[model samples]
Target: MGFLGAPVVGVDELVDRIDPRPVLESRTIHEGYVFDLVSETADLGEAGTVRREFLRHPGAVAILALDDEERLVVVQQYRHPVGAFDWEIPAGLLDVAGEPPQLAAARELGEEADLRAEQWDVLVDYWTTPGGNDEAIRVFLARGLSPVPEAERHEREDEELGMPTVWATLDNVQEAVLSGRLHNPSTCIGVLAACAARDRGWATLRPADAPWPEHPRRR
Candidate 1:
């Protein structure tokens, strides 16, 4: 049978069957504060061989924090790469060794948004750009939020020092996203996923510390 003029197929039939190419050689080309550039040669079996360069990222987390008013907590910060002030969810790099992604998310929420959540759940996971980078991100849904104690607040540094945090309605965020005013990948993914989760009564959300075998930091 066909649906939408396309032949239907079982989910199992859509699984990738090709084996991953074997890496022939790999070397670090540059090391930066956040990630490293690496060049690699791989044997692609029937496709012959190829050499590619990509970033070796340390992974990161984004938090979609919703407060009692159902407003999203977001941060407006300057991203040097894009040379623009981006409206993004509370996020940070997973540079801390051995720190769980959830903990990292919580820490970023506190530091960037100055809020703490008593409830958290895994919303989504995505690769920022698998074609050229190994950067993976986990988006989390946080609720039951309260301001972090002043004494325990984290001081911002560098680009984060002057960044401003705000709370916005989901409708306004969706408009910004659709209008291309907000282009941050994490923010886009987090907001869209949060919207879907909310529509479904958040039944799709996983536990805050859900097992993430695919996250490199966890492995």
Candidate 2:
């Protein structure tokens, strides 16, 4: 073993504690919200120690805003968990196994933003609270939008609760982060990445919605 308990494994070793035991388990007790406790188990001696824990659903996806005019997209909704409705971006969990993150992004844009992108690029993929959950958000940068009729879109059970899409400049979003208005990491990172990707000119995709009037700068 290496340090305290770190193993001297090869650089190619992809998994930690190859024999990791399922420490505990559970199941989803509700809906519309994220996290469905899947199962649980126990870990024995040697490779590690004993611990209690629960399994969880894999995760979902989040997409930053796009104005179809090379601008950023943001959405607003009342997050009871956060206790206030604020402008954020489009995001949701994947319900189907083997579903593509890009497809999910397209669907969310249509359902939440009433827009669709002509092109979608993989932005970044990361786990959210891996220490306690298996949830991961695969973010994508969408460009080139086309509006889908509201009738064709299936509003999420909670969307009727009022999730609406708003668009803004990336610089504005960066400012919101600094001022403490935006705290969602997925939104922050996705916007930052999209900003950089814009300069790098990843790829141009068509947009579904007509560009909205620019909101006055946040003082």
Candidate 3:
């Protein structure tokens, strides 16, 4: 629809799409524990072929846990690349082959926060860095929170060790995001999306098992 005298663009064209180009040349430059750096040349038909380098990721999942009082659970963990202990939603990589994303999210929630949820919904999905990396992350909204049994909790290691968790109101988190305080992509997108979904009576939420066609593994 047009707005404020602006031209209306087709809604169908607004979505990101798969425009597969013929790969002219490709090679892995570096192999890392988490992701691989790859360089490739693609034939863009009339636009000509071009080469690019990016990190090929296996995708990931994040959980935005909310309690009955509508407080969100956020975790603080040191990110070496950024050199800061950033606040983020419970999240982890999709490293296990053949595991479902929702299950992965549940696992992250338990492992990172020592919590579990009785209900789950797809909050949002996004690419962390489309220009330089192929990392896609699916965020899930988790409700009906409870602590995991002490005997069954996963041990934290490295950056995860000594991590602290906090429960904040959704509005406060949203403000933090808008004010450029919270920089984690999953946490920012997840909280803002949760607010939007809640405003719409959660009618916009998708099933936890919703198809994620954009995931590189799925492709």
Which residue pairs collide in model 3, if any? Answer: none
Which predicted model would earn the best TM-score?
3
TM-score for all predictions? 0.90, 0.69, 0.95
Better TM-score candidate (1, 3): 3
Which runs of model 3 end up more than 4 angstroms from their true locations?
1-7, 10-12
Q: What is model 3's C-alpha RMSD?
A: 2.1
Q: Point out the higher-scoring one by TM-score: 2 or 3.
A: 3
User: Per-residue lDDT of 1-219 in model 1, one digit per residue for the tens?
Assistant: 687788889977974333457999999999998889999999988989999999999999999998776789888899887899988998989999989889999999999988999998999988888889978899999999998999999999988997888889987898899888899998888888888888999898999888775555565
Q: Estimate, for each residue in 1-219, the C-alpha lDDT of model 3 and write its tens digit.
A: 467787777777688786668998999999999999999999988999899999999899999999988899999999989899999999999999999999999999999999999999999989999889989999999999999999999999999998998999999999999999899989999999999999999999999999888776776
- Give the CA lDDT, 0 to 100, for residue 179 in model 3: 100
User: Which prediction has more favorable lDDT, 2 or 3?
Assistant: 3
Runs with alpha carbons beyond 4 Å of true place in candidate 2: 1-34, 38-47, 150-160, 199-219
Question: What is the C-alpha local distance difference test score of candidate 2?
Answer: 0.64
RMSD of each candidate?
Answer: 2.6, 9.9, 2.1
